[model samples]
Target chain A: MHRIGDAPKVRRALVSAAVILSALFLLLPLVAIFAQAFSAGADVFWRNITQPDTLSAIGLTLFITVLTIPVNLVFGVALAWLVTRFRFPGRRLLQTLIDIPFAVSPVVAGLVYLLLYGRNGWIGGWLDTHDIQLMFAWPGILMVTIFVTCPFVARELIPLMQAQGSRDEEAAVTLGASGWTLFRRVTLPNIRWALLYGVILTNARAVGEFGAVSVVSGAIRGQTNTLPLHVELLYQDYNTVGAFASASLLALIALLTLATKAGLEWRAARREA
Target chain B: MSIRLKNIAKTYGKAGRGVSRALEPLDLDIHEGELIGLLGPSGSGKTTLLRIIAGLEAADTMSDRPSSIHFGDRDVTHLHVRDRRIGFVFQHYALFMHMSVFDNVAFGLTALPRKQRPSSGEIRARVQRLLEMVQLESLANRYPAQLSGGQQQRVSLARALALRPDVLLLDEPFGALDAKVRQELRRWLRHLHDELNFTSVFVTHDQEEALELSDRVVVMSNGRIEQIDSPEVLYRSPANRFVFEFLGDVNRLEGHVHDGTLTCGDARLDVDLDEGSHELLLRPHEIKLDEHPTELAHLPVTITAIAPVGAEVRVELEADWLAEPWLATIRHADFERLRIKRGQRLYAIPRQWHQFPAANQRSIASETMS
Candidate 1:
């Protein structure tokens, strides 16, 4: 092939170098966690991972992921549909507010929840009088998880739905589709891949969330502790194998997230093709 | 079904500030089973009018100027698009990219409310029938992305017809196809309309497409209809100068008329008119070229170019008195007989000419015997 630029060799070299460096930067930590987790052998790694506290942490993480994904799915789709399909006052402001969780620190999000639900905080006393526990409990952990992961689905969907536009929906409507029928047959099919994409990202964040869950979880050994908090607790106790093993489980979840996302993206590309 | 639109108008943005009228308050009646073409340039309210009829847009609503749109006897101006029972084909086809051609055509049938909905087996048969109509049955299972642009548009057509809507509206149905494909689709759509005998209103900016496809063509510009007539009448007797100029290529002759003589620069033509500045319009086929001047209206010019294509021979004429070169299309036999060539001097005689006094007013007159 003929060269098309003044310094093609140098440009190619620079791009390759950047790509290689970033790939290493991203992959090194993932490799190290698995390496350290199994350093004492598979038997020890399995033992650490199978411990009752570790198992409970995994369960809490899965439970939170399961609970949060569906809620965010509904909220994300509704918000995206409203923002993109209508012209109303404060529409831009609504879009920006939806992105707040992405911009705010996860720890700050947890603190905001605590300020609203802590024992001495606003509404916390009322909740205590009713014998409802929120702070340092599953509810607090779940709330923080939902807040931080809220934007994933909406953010993915808004631009896509905007780009797709309302033409198909209008076409469907003219063909005698009711509101629900239009959504199920026209709008939903169009956004299904993006919704899957958003769900996967939300699931990954809900499982691997650290700061927010850490603040509200109170590191409660087997109750409020998620996988990340349990990893921290094991490290603090100098149970290195246990800590790495728990960390590896989180890494595995992240890998599964990546795989599912990749699979969805492949299907989306095929659909487009 | 027949449609009657009463005083329908639309405006965008805040009134009296940055508002622009997209459609003037006007009434139109389309007979049942007639295919009408809304022909105009961009922003001329052709697509806007079509959308309003489809219930995709709400017409202007004011206490003093209420708009009503009717399909047969049913008033549907305030009705939702789904309830209005109109089938629309968008310019981009808008076929569901994720759905197979069969499912895309089945969408409308399945979307009907429970009591009105057809059985699954009935839907399957209806979809297959529509697919057969559009000649896309073999590609039933293929997704829209798998087919070519023309095929996708065909699938869209079948889908639109699935519900058996009272009226069908196509917005530049063949706009995205190639020239050959556009011609093919035009013929196909015309055939389908005739076979099904359904009322349809289509919007197009292509004069040829509009004239060829429409039973009656409505020429519009600046949110107002310039003329509405059969294609033959519209071509032969345009209602106004805008309609005349917009329909085809026009040669413009600007001059002052005085004492039965029209003079522009050095060129002169014996035309009886009031003493005032005027512009004469001539179609390419209206000007007859000869070796010498005739007794009627004539102008002398030198040939600049000659293009012999299709059935007509187009000759370009230039003269010092002419502001813009005049184009003339003659028969092939005439071209061979005259031995027309570049730089050949010839005289142009006007068989007839048209003029517009108030821009929108039509004033066509034949030259009087001197």
Candidate 2:
């Protein structure tokens, strides 16, 4: 019996090794940034935090992330429900299209936004004629972030919704439940945990987004600059301590996201047990 | 309430894709408060009939019957499953993974109109009562995943019965459980049926389970009903050969019948006869081994094989004057007392010759399938 399960131990060892290697490989740059930030004295760190422009960048970044993630969540769950629960014309195409953001380069996503909503672009030109500004603004930065992170929640929810099924809904219907009651009392509770997981993933992806935001954001020092872009701008201006201080904060946030997600799943398992 | 199915059938796919019939045109009546077991092998359309009753499925010609299912004063054949008030227990339990056992049971109850929803306290009391009915009161706070398979099914049973459904349908409720658990649940279910007596329809392939648990077992073969009778009647007097062979072990003797008597193998017997070639039916337990005939003449035969099964021994024999195999069962003690050994010459005496008329004979072709 022990001999039969020994193969699983070997597989576990290989997977653990691969995971550790990949984690270190991915996390080193962020670690290096934090290390560089700490290289300087405390006075430089104070200078970085107290700077009004830096404070504004951090505020704007947090604001955009909070705003964009929920948008992604709404669209993602809708997209997931549309794809998994119903079969319609172009369903396969719609499924692939929902995931296109995952494969698309963030910069390309920014360009698509530009072609549609830039100052000289389709809707942009019309809006601008009436003094309505979308580009070089906070809303524009959020739009780009939403486009790049749209797939995260849907990706997490699609397989879950597909597996959990619509049986309970049918059961509810046979029990004389109306549509909304069926969804609220039957479907929603079933998908609640998966939806929470999707929301978490969307928040993580939204907060960490960088490149697409760079092109769409005009990088106005105190207005459009997100944390990652601010770090870049500060680094280029030779404010090394400020750059690393901000980078460390982001690194901490990313670490917390991973730990929270893991903790959530562990707690879920325990509750189920 | 009465379920009247008239020429009800179902077909899959369009003409170009090659049509497949899931159910053929058939008629049936299911009365209220009756526990009807649809017994069949897989793909026999028993499930289709249940689904049709539950309003989950619509038969092609069912719409044409203007009067199909009359639940009290209402016509429900064309209604959606939502309006059918049918409680279904799926084989997998289908309990919502995220919901606690109580919540799972309370889901259907909560689906009522806002004004009709029981008070929170009332709902809790009702749920607790149902959980107790299924003997799962202690597990009420636990979610479905936390329970064992038996417990999950019990919770599912509690949930299905929570709303006081007009009809309860179970698609092989214990089909997924282990033997001991299946047997235990069978007793509990039988008790529940007697207590509440909700109109129940269950589909099963287990012959013993159908016989033991159902008020009446409807044996189906190839999407057709072979027989519908109580277990005792089904065993003692089967409607056809398919029913006889399906309900228990049987020994078929090949021979022709004339003038109400059939010479079956080496045994001459009286039987009901109509016309054409005929045969006689004999169950293994109905046959006895004797050195000399008491009433019927003993047929000396070679004991080909002896198989011991727990407390019983099955002896296979071939008579010299007959071109068919004969079998008889004896208790382990009886087998030992008789000193049965393989390849030994013995005498076989059948206590009764069951008549195989044309209707039951039409089922012999199906017994090959059984």
Best-matching candidate per lDDT = 1
What is the CAPRI rating of model 1's predicted complex?
medium
lDDT of 2 by residue, B229-262 (tens): 7888787777886777778777776656667545
Q: List all candidate RMSDs to the true structure.
A: 2.6, 5.4
> Mind giving the per-residue lDDT tens digits that candidate 2 earns over A138-196?
88888888887788888888998898777777667777888888767777776777778
Most DockQ-accurate candidate: 1
TM-score for candidate 2: 0.81
Cα displacement (angstroms), candidate 2, residue B260, comes to: 12
- Residues A1-273 of candidate 1: C-alpha lDDT, one tens digit per residue: 656544878888888998899778987888999999999999999999889999999999889899999999999999999999998889999999998998999999888888889988799989988999998989889999999999999999999999999999998888888788899878998888889899988998899899988888798898889999999899999999899999998888889889888887787788556
Instruction: Compose the digit string of candidate 1's lDDT tens values, residues B105-163.
Output: 99988878889899999999999999999998899999888899999999999999898
